[model samples]
Target: MASKDSIEMDQELAKRLFTEGATVVLLDVPKGTDFGIDIKSWNTGENFKGIKMIPPGFHYVHYSAVDEFGDIAPRVGFIHWFSKSEFLVKRWDPKEEELSSEPVPEEIVQRLKDNLMNLDRYLGPYPYDTWKQWQELTNRIDSTIIERCAPVCGYIRSALELENCDDKSRPRGAETSRKRKRGACLSDEQKEQELLPDLKPKAGTELRLTELPNLHYPEGSTPAEITKHSLDSSYTLDLLLSKLKQPIEIIGELQLAYVCFLAGQSLDAFEHWKLLVSLICRADSAISVRRLIYIEFLRTLEAQLALIPEEVLYDIVASNNFVYHNLRRLFANIESNSEVDARLKSEAVRMRDRISTKFVWDFSNLQEEEDDEAPVVVSLDAE
Candidate 1:
């Protein structure tokens, strides 16, 4: 029967994957811990070890610890570039309730490998359904981009790690006076505790993302030029590109930020992703000059937008957020710029049409809207 043939084919594919794919050995994680790769997630069982048969390339591995009361800790994750048939071993630290910072010993890794067959039942197969989509989203990212942008601590956390601020870093003046008045009647021990420094995000936990150029106009620009640059951020885009070895790297960073936010749930990555989107969408002149970059940008943005959950999309579009505003500006610029390549302009139009149909946005009134906000020059005669 045809059904039997399909089952056999699937079985063969599974065997191939099991024989050729990489493996990750996670040791001693607690039951009910949340674990996931790419877009798939599940709570772990007592017998859970890690993932196996992972396709070779970039993948995100994330997890969150669950407490006795069923509360989940903030998510933490890392990106890994797997080689075919590679083996990676990691262990949990009960004290820290996280993956151990220290590397697994080579002897232990070898022992695990020697007994991998016995442990196979404890491992989960990589979720294959979304693998192709994940590949497309991360096609531009590589090891170099990961090393450049990932935090020094090697973990992307949904919540920033906080530490007590030193006296020098604590607020002074009015804030100090207000705190004093509030704590005036407290016991000495309580007052000492109140005076203790507030907690702040720990150093070294920040992603080393490329610095974005300032939005201000260049110093030597005339008034008219400043106004023009304000409307079209092509000059700022050029400055940002100049700092990179290649313009495409911007797309890589964009992909990295998006992945961190999507998989690790890091808000910092979300903000960086938004900023990058704003920069790209506002570069009106760059569409013509950097035709290839614009083409790739459109492709990347289209894929990312398609994957965004509807609820998130609602939040982004409902408030006329940065994405909606900048995309409108980008489309308008593409429509008016005669120098843009025909193919690029056609692509932009198609994207615009798709966005309009999907989001019920009206792009036809852009000209009228721009005219309404046009700057007025007042002329005054000296008396």
Candidate 2:
């Protein structure tokens, strides 16, 4: 009789075959390109065909085309949901620098399926090593969220395009907002707008979550206190929390977005991160809620900051101005009470100091009312 581990491995292999899985056959891809699905990466060789036994669901396929001189094209990727037993195929177009797919003749697909054993050497196996991470990243992305957040184009890929679309705020103009001035402070109206509910994100672009407005005030700030300040639905964290009845759903979405962003290089994930930051910062959630979740948020942010490549990190910080701005705002409100709060505050301060010391960018002057157009560079002479 086989040992327990051997028996388990054999059982797993047999179960994988019986359970529905998908196959991808990529043809004519450049020999030196790096291709990946989910968390598994493969360097293409002469006989490279595709990946096999893909567990059927959503997966991100990405590639970096390389040239003889070691130059790399901007990485491009797409997300696809493979049906059970799906046999998808694609052919690479060198001129277009993209993969193109069409309906494969049934006979050809049948032949490939029958000869899978012969082609096994060319097909890479599903990466069990990275499956757990991928699962954690994707498990919370339910069908409803997927349907809501998917770009209108019916295909998911990375490329920023400017088109004639209605201005979200004005609804009448075709203007795309430009970068802010060096020292711009948001007006009272602008500050309030941040708390307004953003129910539907624009279509034909990367998917992003809506920032549900906060409606609840802390115990001390009653209706009269809020009314005196002319606080509208915009400052209603209670309302936002009510809308998000299942807070775990939101947290899971954040984790999924972050993991996809870091591991799969999904630009869509970056957009999602921005949405999450906007929600958390502007919601002005109760102190208890903030205390409970701030550490997790801080830890996640630190992990991302530590792991991201320097070049990419700079680009992200520069392009996504809300990143540090919102983080600073989040940290500013932590009233430093219990031991947990103190520890979280320490971590937050450490992160701020690290960025200031290493990057010469100071978060000390970050104001909640100001739009962070760019980092404040501190000169050595000024110190």
Candidate 3:
């Protein structure tokens, strides 16, 4: 079924990639250990040394240590921007059972380069099938965003890095409750003892994400103004945008959070992604003011929604989820607002229809439901 020209073009592209793409020379990794770059993953074989023919740009390299019993540890990964024909070397630490932190000597790296042909058989080709999707997901992201958002440890872990809490790090007023029913059997020492310090995440393990502004109304607002701002988050959105160097960086952050969640399995990234979505969707007035942002937001959101598993989009018991509610609100706001740019409005409508068709979600009654119920106010104040 292949045309001669098309087949020839494919061959030519493959040849170019093979000759010009980057290489990562990982050494001494266990045969059964999990190894991956970007979206593709595989168990390392006995002869596996590293990956080759990686198309130049950003890539996330991740792996999990496996035990003899076949139990796997939490996944850990780092993002790196590769250059064409660049050769990088890393070695496994047998004692630590992970990649060594020490840098490879230049002389040794040169020697490996000298013997590169002999090592070619052990290298795996990069997975090309998911490459396009990965690029779309990360198009807005770049080196600056990566440096700002990545964890200080320079890697992401699926599991939180927790450590035992010291006395100084313990919470104040953490004593055991004294209240008890009369005649209840209790240990006197247990009742008097202060609660133990809770384990906490290691300092450098946390991602340096941009902090989201509070969703509540600004200080000194009248009751009516508070209610209005609460119904629409455009004011809060402006405040958040003011902190960013460019409005487009918000999209970059959104992309970064998504890759961290999808590839690194970070729940923290998932939470951040949800917060960003909520903020963007609630900003009704922002659609007209930031038309470019809304356009990119819709495009990015559509791509992300397609990749998300169906189970995450809806809940059988709950009927609908956070994404459903927020998206419905967004569509209702865009449809009702006359001030929104025609182009942005059209894109919003197209996205709404696509989502409705794909997910079988009915947006027809969203405006009616919105009118019937009071707008949900997300208060930052604690009770």
- Encode model 2's per-residue lDDT on 217-276: one tens digit a residue: 455785465553232222454455566546545654676576556655667676777667
Per-residue accuracy of model 1 over 80-103 as CA lDDT, tens digit each: 888889999999999999998799
Model 1 deviation from the true structure expressed as Cα RMSD, one decimal place: 6.3
Better of 2 and 3 by TM-score: 3
Off by over 4 Å in 3: 164-199, 314-319, 370-373, 376-383
Candidate that scores best on TM-score: 3
List the candidates' TM-scores in order: 0.85, 0.58, 0.86
Distance from true location, Cα of 91 in model 3, Å: 1.6
lDDT of 2 at 218: 53
Q: With candidate 3 superimposed using the best TM-score fit, by how many Å does residue 276's alpha carbon deviate from the native? A: 0.5
lDDT of 3 at 165: 67
Q: Show the colliding residue pairs in model 3.
A: none
Ranking by lDDT: 1, 3, 2
Compared with the true structure, all predictions reach lDDT values of 0.85, 0.62, 0.84
lDDT of 3: 0.84
Off-target runs (Cα >4 Å) in candidate 1 are 1-12, 163-200, 370-383
Point out where model 2 deviates above 4 Å: 1-20, 67-69, 83-85, 105-107, 164-205, 208-249, 252-256, 263-268, 281-383
> Could you list the CA RMSD of all candidates, in the order they appear?
6.3, 9.9, 5.4
| Model 3 lDDT per residue over 1-383, tens place | 98999899978978988899999999899999999999889999999999998999888999999999999998988888888899999989989888886888999899999998998899999998889898888888878888888888877888988887665674454322334324567577655543544576798887788887754678999877998887888898888888888889999899889888878888889899988999999889888888888888899989898787556555421644677778888888888899987887789889989988987877887677754346665676689
